[model samples]
Target: MESSTEAYVYYDPTKQNAWVDAILNGLGPNKQRYYKVASLQLVTLLVIVIAKTEYFSAISEVETTSCAVGLMNMIGNKGGCAVRLRLYDSYLCFVVSHLAAFTNNCERRNQDFREIAKRVLFKHQSDPSLAYLSHAWNGGGDEGVAYLAHHGTVLDSSKQASVFHADHLIWLGDLNYRINLSEAEVKQRLAVNNYEELLDYDQLMIERRAGRTFPMFEEGPVEFAPTYKFDAGTDRYDTSAKRRAPSWTDRILWKKPILGREGLTQLNYNNCMAMMLSDHKPVQSVFRAQIRELNRQKQSATRRALQQQLTETPEEMAKGTISSSFIEFDDVQFLEYKEKTLVLENTGQVVAPFYFLAKLDEAQAIPPWLQVSPQQGLLGPGEKILLQFEIMIDASVSAPFNQGQELSHILILRLENAKDFFISIRGNYQRTCFGVPLHLLSPMTIPSVNAEASLTSPPERRKHLLQSAKTTLANPSDPPGSVSPSSSSSSLSTSQQANLPKELWRLLTFLWNKNMLTLPNLFLEHGDRMICDYIRKCLDAGDTFDPSILLGEEEDQTQEAVGANSVIDVLVAFLECLPEPVIPTQFYAEALAASDAPDRIKLLKDKLPPLYRNVLLYITSFLADAIQYAPAAVKQDRRSCIVSLFTVLLRPDLAYKETNPALAQLKKEKLISHLLSIA
Candidate 1:
């Protein structure tokens, strides 16, 4: 066989490739350099069975010249050629072919085309096109049938074939041929081959349906159109159209194919698959041709895989066991190591030795979080070995890979008998603009870069840094380029506090708090501090800010409605968070106060949403703060709104569904009122 070079066409960044590289890297400087020596090799080969079907060829070609496409040409050098692939367990190759004005016409009357198709079918072990097995077209008998030399025949397999059947063929196509068998002719034909209408369209009785054998669909007496069109702007007997005339030059043939055609599919079209790259439509069918033995092998392999998962438990097998303690590595990067830092001391004394085989998580194809080990090997007892590596990553990975997001890759270092030690093999995330840490950007004040030029009206530090940032975002390159990573914290205009959306805002806030507290708090006490901050900021300044600018559209002189369409509801809600006594007067006044400075006005208006939200927060905070000391009227108002807020929380996207204490706070705030209302 003069076969072309085989190419896999798979080069994605999959873990298998990474595993191979890591294994090689872990062999150490000498061994790694030795692999570069090009003599050693590790390889595993697999002949994969896959279903490669034209999943959508049928419906897409509806407006084509034909109904079903059949018998496309096949070209392959030797090796029995190639045929359509199928799933492992199925039987019968079902095909729903569409019609074509030019396709399935047996264009050239010779064995050449049929031979090509047959070769292709046998090579890949697939079945025939659906259209080829339908009722004879154009009054022609089953004379046009084409079957492969070594493959099964027929195309009706998908429809009538039973599970026990090998391949009952079904050829679904626009059979442009009209059948005309007299009572005697029908009997004779029936006797010769089991003849029956593949699929019956009303008004096309075998005898009455007989037409110009070329269009087996309908006759022109009822103004039926011809089953073909060659010229443009021609009149048709069927329906209306421009440019080209209309015709029903489509058809489907039927019979049982030997190979499996389980998920046979179809679509109507003017052309067929024969000329898939042509101006006409094409037919597409799915075929499953499994030798029973092959089917058993594939099924057994699949069952074993599923069973492995179904029967798995950490209690069984080598390498290691589970534990939460961190193993000490004197000189180790933990990420990329050329040696196993964990030398299993006293292997005979210890009862087990295990290591993590793979990471478990719900991550995208290539998550940014990854730790690559550069070296590894079995360690013996009583050896204090040196394993060195670096923690490599960016801030994105260290958004702390938890269990759901990731099952937490605690690199299991198992000492023979001791419980498995888990080290967080997560990337070390570092983020900076130029060289300045993003954390440095967190504080509310920073010095002006141009402080030397203007001292008399020296700009405030936060304002200067903000203006500098605005300038940087606008024009990344400074006219007079300058940068200083050691710069101090800059002031924030309350809301650019974080440009993150509320959902991400919550995450960003957590990250910020983590940087502040250096630990995930016990029972989220930081949440209390956070809510208090929100309340203070909201009551004092939240309402003063304009949400119209931040959350919605900013007015543009040229385009008045060019801003985003957003309601100030969240901002408004923030105002309602404040304590009742201070809110109606203090916060509301703060909200409505006019700012003469446009910048200050924008700033203050922007503060309004947060302020309004804090009104609600403060009310809740007061209940916590005042305990039972609240005034009767104020307490009553809080009681009423708390119930309403709980009802509002039935919605999904808002604050309540959150797992944080905030959601619990909302729920808890309503608990007393909930009982009273129910009572």
Candidate 2:
């Protein structure tokens, strides 16, 4: 009941418009930003967008006072989190909290701290160590929230034992109470309260009575000074005695001296950016300290889990694992493949520690190595050794060094020739997911690789572009059963040659000067079987002609191939043969769809019938797809192609049921079902 999702929650798409409006007005990164931009809608024009990202950790601020110890509640979370970062041999819960109210309900304050601990415990359900990271939140300044006000159970003396006993507790918040308060003054203050609330706010105490949290207190003057101030003159702060000095808010209480058992102890309130971010001047204390119990616990737990995953087989670690380290990387180093350098380390026992590497094509192992490392000494039970190496990498291996360009490869290396060494590196393979043979090091690699040109759209958009080209050539009727020649055939200008593919231009020159519609013979119409057969004859052994051959030739070549006076070639030329752009979008889609060399063959060869069928969907699918398949690349052109395609596909043109119908009607409920059936 304390925390529940409200109806019409943030993700409801039904209220999408309203949500966008609200977000544009105000927004937040909830749950530390795991749920980012789940919805992005353009609410208006002429607006600016700013982006902020939050990664692993977060900081919180709360009000408190009347507490002697500062607190920081280290709640463990599961985004690559852990416990056990050993600081100075002692282990303490990694928690931080502001001072609690020196008030009536000590039990309530204790419960809140417990709740924080529980939260950390729950966040890391799988961690084996004692759960959570907690620290005392303390304060000192009179300007900020007072520690003894409402929830200051942290001060309850009765609960001091358990609080002190907690194994890994760190205190780093404002506490109105001071460690060096005069004994008489401390005694006098306690007299005002009864039983000190048996609840003890007992999470832990500054010092004195303590049980387990921290086994033994680190001797004398360990806890001291007022973490806060009361300066009414500043208006930002108030000055008063009971109103201040005793504030122990910003203190870091550890089992023993943290940095070096013997080190200077001073508080610096300047490390934090105070004037702008917080109303109170933040406090920071540095003890040339070692790690804390909770710190070790968290760190150990996280590293262990990551190491565990690295050792798992792909089948075992199919899903992604935590990568605290990966987040810190600048850019991934993609190494070029080397034969001798590629060695896999074996981690399994009873197997002569196989040191074999894998290739891009092979899932398990390959003949050539992707990586190479000096042989690590044999690792047997209780056998420990570290590797030290220095090898001059030969430029010939990748050629990047030799050629001054880049070369990339996917190679897996196992530690000690282990099974799953370099498992984390697998993600880099997606960059080369498409099965293609890349130049080991192209001579022109550094010439700035560009993206593939956008596919020439189905002639529909610039129907006029082609029409204008067509007009340059004089028209000829079916020359009485053989393409009829136009009176101006002899006068055909150079412009007419510009429109046709090279091969078509040549063949057209030999054919009668007839228009494509009513070729010389009924069998010769552009789409008629005879014309195709004739073209097939020219392309194959006979005449060596086919539809694809025509499509493949360049415009200038086809134009010249289809010269004006031609009799036979004019009737069968490729440029003049394709169905008009008014044809169904699906028809163009098929050509675009099967345009890929392999897919088209598959379609032509019936390799994947559905893809061939799916081709019917796009007049021209996204140009991004084309760039990926091309021998030549064109980047920006592909983006423009995609933008134009989205606009055109949505336009009501020739009806193409196979592809667009599904897209237009694609709702969440029906998408998966339809995708399963088609391309």
Candidate 3:
């Protein structure tokens, strides 16, 4: 007896009847003995499946299903033909498609591919009688029986079904993407047998490089000549007047499931030049594929052995050691990133698998801003792994930290079948001007308490002081210099009153005193992180700036100062972090609509609250000074820079639901430009 083989065919019924009949007849008498036609679906196109009779028996009893999607003439003619089946423990899907034709229709081809992948639906056949019996055993009533009878087939209802769920997928068809070169150039390249040079202009390859299509699919390299635009029944190129450029329109691509361990290797990819009945040449690929099989007896035995070993192991054999039980990070500022490394070692003789335990109310083992790489892993005896802990404070989660919330977390690392270790992570979240309400910051006075003394204070006393500060800000009627009872002795003197926050004034004064405004790219690029941190610490502590700290003892007199860029960064950060923009939200539309600098200035003064108006005028005045000091050639550049930087900072923080955010942003830039023209 001959070995059984399977044949799947997808054809246009309008034109391929004779070819189909020929293929069916060529199968011969032995085909009937070994094969059976499992499915025949006819839409505008036809999908015919012929499988070996012994194939089902060899894989045990299960159902195989097929689905089709039509993409021509409103769900007619050409599209995708798919077959899904389970072989052993693996689910495989095979798809064939005929995409859009022509050289410039590559986007259409990609659209067709995406449509077929999304719309193809496969219904798994279920035994209604079996379902009824199971329902009855579970004490279900007539409703369950009626449901089974009404819906005989079960559709896969997963968020993503069909090809996306398969363990291994193979897709092949005439995708019809043409080469980018002109016909004359293509012919010249082909004459020289420069396949590589010609392929560089292939539209499909270009699309893949741009990541517009076939992002996860892999294809074998084409060593053969173009398999398209040939004259039927001849090896010569097309001789007609509409000389189409030769392209590798026919293609075969495959993707491995994200988590599947199976392997697929393409051994050969070539075209059948001898059979030239159509303008397009027939292409084929041979693949070596791996399938998984399950053995229940062996699986059970291994599980039992593992269980016994776990139960009988001595305590010392299961122990693991962590490098540290406590990790302390330096002061974290808004939009700043910090990282630390923790080493984990398996000090045991046996393998150890460990995972972090989440708090009872939390789903994640760590906080949102804190990320732990390799949160769970297995380590062999004497093996060590470095675990990285990173913290970042971005806009989304900055409000709490800016409001004096501490940055701290505790992680519970549990060794499977062993003990749990506690690791405490702590960091001081420095307060910044970014997320504070303008009104609260305007009249609020910075406490004169020593930062080091505050750090060493009792936790309860610190908590009380932070809460009192927030309360004082929350109540607008409270006197500006009101101090929390706990820190009355260290309260700010009335002489320090200012219309704007002290932090903002300090940043501006530094820029002015250091002659930093004319520095190029000062606001455009990031500053030295170490210097920035020191600046932030001083600002938070309300301490006077000590140039010596930054200059160092040797103070290589010739060395350029390093804090200019950092000061600018901190200034921008403060403006961006403000809970409300300097231009209040309610007047955004009116401000953008103002026609002239005088009109914008009038609107700013009239509509903005007193403090907000003060801040806008103050910042723009500094910008005007910067431009005035710039060289004649760079004055316009300086003005443009100020407009660019402040446009985003001063705009309201409302979400733009406009259809075009770019247009709205342009309007804001125009408004800022008007303001800068007269500043």
Candidate 4:
């Protein structure tokens, strides 16, 4: 079979659109051998054309005219073009898109693809002059008859006009997916022809695996070298200051047709390395597609025969059963994993294909923390499958849980051609100090052990307690002795006027009193889990540490004591876990600048919040003492290690790390070291 070819060009208005005629004239000396089906230009960025050979035109017809959607001027940059062709009774859609560029804007590119897919509309062409005439004249006019013959009402509605409606879809163009590695790292790997390792870091592959972009699309193996980021007219990479990392920005990807249809097999996929007029190399792909042809009269007769047979002997309905309608997990802790299993069984004689459906207006079928494996599947009669539901809370999603939002959802279980079932999932998220704002945590009193038990109480009672606590914390001006409605019986009281949180002070004093800072690898290694949990419980309960409970008759009283490192670890974690660091991120620039000034301490103190100022001073003072008393053998390097450790704990926010991580980290270390010297 002869291969079908497609091309895309950037539109230049100044050239008087000569490329259109050039493309048509270049086809061949025999003009009647090919036909132009559609042509469209979007803004000044994209030009698309669809043409077919004389043999193909003789066999099939053009179903719809070309449609273009521009995402550049108003919403974003770049856009897409789409057209449909019909061969026998099957519909095939062809799409060419140019997505957003740059490595950091990968999410933007994904958004562009979704926007184009959702907004592009294919409509039949009708003369505007006929709409203003009489209805009777317009209804039976020659133009209306011509329009119906050439471009019939192919799509009933906007929803049905999407690319997914076609029997076979082919999507190709400059996708602009970049490599996730640094420029130097990409160059090092490419030098040795290490395409396999480089593909692991490809942004497109990573996003595809995470189901964030192009969820069901498939691409052939990219065995060729990087197809982007080269010096124009030369094979060497970009020598400019930008130093853009090489990427597979130009490529092709396709989604298979629906079930019961033949699939497409990729024949060839590679790049044109010799033609380097632009920074990006040109890529091409060929596929061997199997097309199914049908006779309309015969197809209609067969459908009627099948319907007559179905009426004579009715078919059984699909039915299924679930192990439970309600699933509850154990109490969830911050950064901890909790999971539950659900069993789905096909109880009926017929095959049952079930899927978890998302609620209306929601992007995902399940919440970010909760994951349902095998979201959709088919089950044979008497077949059962185990569905694992798991939940994990990390910093990105901890804000809502810490704000007293309940962890629960109602998932809709849908069976094809059957009724839908609702499954209720609920879990108790234990509140912690980790993700709570400093201002909010400062005004709230620690609940007693019995008050903590209220988290597991009935829904109404728990809601009342959480609402009262939130109300009390919202007013930072509340008096020190004010008590929340839920915890009025407890001895603990709010201290809105405290300079620093008592929890932080407790951890700091324990490390100082126990001399745990002198221990080797003091914050470098993790501590015992049991001891760390004990320290956390004590801090939250407003109770002092009990050496008898932690040490348990060991009586060593030396640096070798097992609890020493644990205490230090808990202290550092306390500071690191605070929603805002000891030195708030907003003041980072000022602090770095102040490090070189004569009155660095005074400059920083004036700029910092009272709570932050006090916390920074208290921790640095303790570190100064530890450095002074360090043993001679390790004293020289101890200060530097301490600086590095505190730099990480104090700043914590590294959102800008991708730009120049090493330089930013060095600046932070210098600032911390200067603070320690003065302390």
Candidate 5:
């Protein structure tokens, strides 16, 4: 509705008053009793469908906006209205908007929608005390809530404004996107009940494909006929001289919030085809949106407690604590899943906003074996939330801890602008064959395959595999002599490799390679050299490697499973795949003896070939470098593994077993310390 007095403004409440009154009067007594006006702005209206008078009374926090973006700001009036109300425990947002109109102005219409979206803001209108309490509980007041909402929720506050900060967002209005067909062609399609065929040419669909409108919104199929360009009081299409093509102008779309009820399901979406008071028929959509129902009485009690806690002294506010200072998982069976809950309570006055932060210098914030939920949140005073801490040592999760070392970890939880709390979490992972050396996997002393082994051997193995398969099928329980040794060896290798999951296999291969040659060799051959360069570039620049690429397909799943991320996740997986340390399980005593041997340096040097020695030295050095990227509290375990490796190499079991005991003890401390320092 254009303003009669001012050409600059399209919203004139004075001019809309009479129309509003007429509409209200037209709604008969029965209809009037069922519906109440939630908002009315120039030419745009929002009405809540209520079953009873008490229903209308439950609604709260009404917000409205009218944006004039028409020519000279006089003809078009884009308006929006949003109401925030709690449907049980779920908060709902109902929005309505009117955008710019015209057949070929879809881009302009999109701009109008964006403007309305940015301008429409909903103010929380709950109890003043509760609102303040929630904000306070958010920890940093408004600032804290805003920050947490950005990091923990789907809504991005740093980007353009949006009304998606609700449990359910239902946007309804005249979207004004038209059909991309001529009037005659649109009618031809409509006459044959081929609405689905017409949808591809729908301007709204076209704009969506072009990424110009409704990025993440979902709307029901337009099974019903188009609602625009109809004659008043009739179902006939536009018969004007300037024939307007039929278009689904008025639309109802919605976005289900990420942090809310299950989701929204469409019950019915169709047009009020019979009513034609204007050129546009009305569109109505009924949705069965899931709402979480909470006990109001219990919530009120919690709020009261929160309020009481808020008024305590600053000293009390600084004193928050968890149910226990340490959580001991004892022993989690490898490749088995177990979960323990840690109850964190706000022991101090005021709200405590808490989030898990990885050690600043560590590549991964949390160990892969441990998974935590609700990475960040706020807790009211005396309020306790159960933090689920899980240990799942599958091939992927165990790859990093494969070395023969005890599984012990310390987790740090930080409170908003407060002291950090340490939670000692430790678990013993069951042993597996994944990370054990080839010789250690079975009693057989398998010869090492040289790096110089023919690269074409894989194809040869495949050829032999076919024959091996035929032999097995021909005689199900054949004797050992039935298959040739090479064929048997290939079959055995294939079977063992197949049993290991993809993640674990890669990890084990990386860890067992005494030298760090696998990476360079693989990349130098098959992988793109640019990727290698990129890694070098990132490292040289002191920039963190992009884990998104390393995790690849596992990125999303891993992030969903664990609260932490690391650039060396793949490397860590390799470590976890080890069933024993680089130095075998029964070699600890030998390692100690070697560390004490007189003339141990020469003895150790003579035991390993130059190639093997270099590889061993490389591995130890690489591990030592990797420790800097590990969490501060967990670095010691990594160092222990490295030291064990160094000990085994410096004091070879064969050489040290026969050493003079007195002489060994004499040089033990100094030589061992020197070796450890270097390692």
Candidate 6:
């Protein structure tokens, strides 16, 4: 190896000018040469690492320097110096330390080594784009280790990654660990050039075996003589009366690299015989470390892959195609469903990844009739994947579509850098509401009354509440249930009341409660049951309640109805009872279309019968008016409820289709848009 002196200047802190010559002298003839020199405690020890500017700039490096106290005052300053570097594809960390010295003090030397190990923390400067590669280590047995790094300003200096976080680690310095033998014994072995025998008494080796020092470090065989305790200016051993035993104190070691893929072969491990500086002979080792060379083609491919991942623009992701733009099912039997698969092909030059999102940012875009899997994923170029879609007709879901409604959904498929694609999903839903009314499912409704008067009249309803109150007051000890009936207030028998739809009594009770039902525990405890019953009742009614009840009547009427606490004249009242609207308020723009449409009745009737269309139109108009009075928060909640309810109610089975498929499709689209709006 060729050697060149960049600059030759010894540092002496005791002098007035520690940097004896011009600092610029450190710059060699090659202006591209860069170097960093660090000193410990007034230049007691120095660590310097150098590399060509181009090479340094081409790699990532993070360095940490710390100093500890070990030996006599001015001579004892120590600590390891470390640098974490990424050369090509491999990460490497190098550490150099000067530990406590002297004979028979291996334990103290081990302690010094530990101090350096603990305090020499590396400040990793990892690339943010490669963040996913942070968890790079996945090994087994004693080699098992994991390293996680991130790009951020480290706030806590005390917390940093250790030197072991790299794929390779090299630790070297004047460790100051002496031999565990007498001077005579060491000389006896050295006289015969028996360095191997002397190594048996090596303090570093003994300390390591006792688990008091470097644990998993590996070192090459030391065939040469010890490099410590030599007479100044001579190749002879210490000549003083207190002759120090020759020990292999100055050394180099490293933990084996991951997978042993890279070998650290010591080509030359020997002591220098020429230049003499102090009482210690300078030791040198020539190593031929095997490094995995980067393959240009592979590297280019990797860079492309990473760059693609980093720049996730929709334009790139939009380059894909679906086997079909729409998937339609003729029917989905209640309580039963079939699974269908749709293929997505990556037709672009680059890899494509996509995800399914809710419609218009609603919590749920897919109707109850549909269930999808693998919400999000990635695809390679020209690759195809089958997405699963199952149509499930749950009884709870069926209740909302009790009239056998059509199920239509415009599902959104979003690509990373591309415009979103809409997949039309059409299916017929079969309705079966638990095969019975809500009254038959519970025990409290057996004695309820039949409110025969125009269900839309408040005065008639008030009379019923008064009669019920009187009847209840007549028996003050009766326990009040959420839907307990006022048996004495009506002419119906227990069986007759039980036979009526449970939703009827529920609505009546809601009217009796001054149109205010505390529903905090409504659907939570008995999941889906309450929602199913409410939906079933709404579908069976074929009628819409009067909006005036919820929007508020005249002040005189409000006062008069105080004790009356009656009348849920409009189906909108059921919507009012909900905390969050079935259709989200954000979609109010779509819902408003229903009310503003000049031919809304005819349009609505195309999908629903005249009775149902009129009912829906009335409710739609009421929602538009309610928006004017409802608070912002209430509007948001109601919007979600409205969408959810209509999503269930507006099924294709309920639509009166014409012979023309295009017109049928147009009618369906109009109905969906109108219903989704806030009208």
- Quick one: best TM-score, which candidate? 4
In what order do the candidates fall by TM-score, top score first?
Answer: 4, 3, 5, 6, 2, 1
Candidate closest to the true structure, highest lDDT = 4
Q: What is the lDDT of residue 390 in candidate 1?
A: 28
lDDT of 4 by residue, 167-252 (tens): 56677777889998999999999999999999999988998899767765789999999988899899888899999999998878
Residue 89 error for model 4, in Å?
A: 34
Q: Residue 395 in candidate 3 has what lDDT?
A: 61
Clashes of each: 124, 155, 2, 0, 17, 45
Per-residue lDDT of 1-679 in model 3, one digit per residue for the tens?
0101100111223334554555567778755544443333323233444556666654422233333322111222346767766566555677777777678768877766766665565654333323322223122232322222222211222112345445567888778889988999999999989999998998888897886667657889989888888887998888889888888998888874343255578999998888777888878898887776667678779779987986687656477888999888877766666778788888888778888899899897877777675566677788997776767677667666654456888899988767888999999876665566666555446532233233224656556655654553344342443321111112222332265677887777666532455555443333555777778767766777777655445644221235565676667767766666777665676776673345556755555555566566667666666666556665664565456556644564467455644355556666776665564
Residue range 1-679, candidate 6, lDDT tens digits: 0011110012233331343222325565754455442323223444444555666645655454554433211112444556666766566677777776568556667766655665466676554343323433311222313211111111111124566666677788888888778899999989999888788778788777886677668888787778878788888899899899988877888876655356477777777767576677767776776544456787679889988875674444347877787888876644454666788877786766788778665787556556664456677778887776766655435443432234777999976666678899887654332332222222222221222232213655535544653443244241322122232222223443343344444444333331232222111111222233434344434344333433246544333332122222223233332222333232233333554574653443343322223234444443333333334545544333333223322323223343543233334345544553534
- Please estimate how well model 4 matches the true structure, expressed as its whole-model Cα lDDT: 0.62
**Which residue pairs of candidate 4 clash?**
none
Point out where model 6 deviates above 4 Å: 1-43, 69-76, 128-133, 137-159, 209-211, 291-679
User: Which run of 10 residues does model 5 get worst, by summed lDDT?
Assistant: 482-491
Better model by lDDT, 1 or 2? 2
What is the clash count of model 5?
Answer: 17
In model 1, the Cα lDDT at residue 547 comes to 38
What lDDT would candidate 1 get against the real structure?
0.28
Candidate 3, position 261, lDDT: 53
Which residue ranges in model 3 land beyond 4 Å of their true spot? 1-324, 330-339, 343-353, 379-384, 392-403, 416-420, 428-444, 447-497, 510-567, 579-609, 628-631, 651-661, 677-679
Model 1, position 273, has a per-residue lDDT of 26
**Cα deviation in Å at residue 299, candidate 6?**
6.3
Q: Write the per-residue lDDT of candidate 2 for residues 1-679, one digit (tens) a residue.
A: 0011121011233344454455555655342333222232111101121223451122111111111111111111100111222223333333344334443323334444334332222111112233222122111221101222122212211112122222333444332233344434533543563224311322335223543222233322322222244352232322344553223334445444322233224443232423332223445554443333346667789878966865663432111111221111122221212121122223343223323366657765421212222232233322333221111222113212222222233334344333334432221111110111111111111111121111113435234433532442223221221211232242223443332222333344433233321222211111223344444334312244443434334544333323221223232222122222212233344434332333342343232222212222221221222223322333333222223222222222334445533233222112212221232
By lDDT, the better pick of 2 and 3 is 3
- 10 residues in a row with least lDDT, candidate 2: 71-80
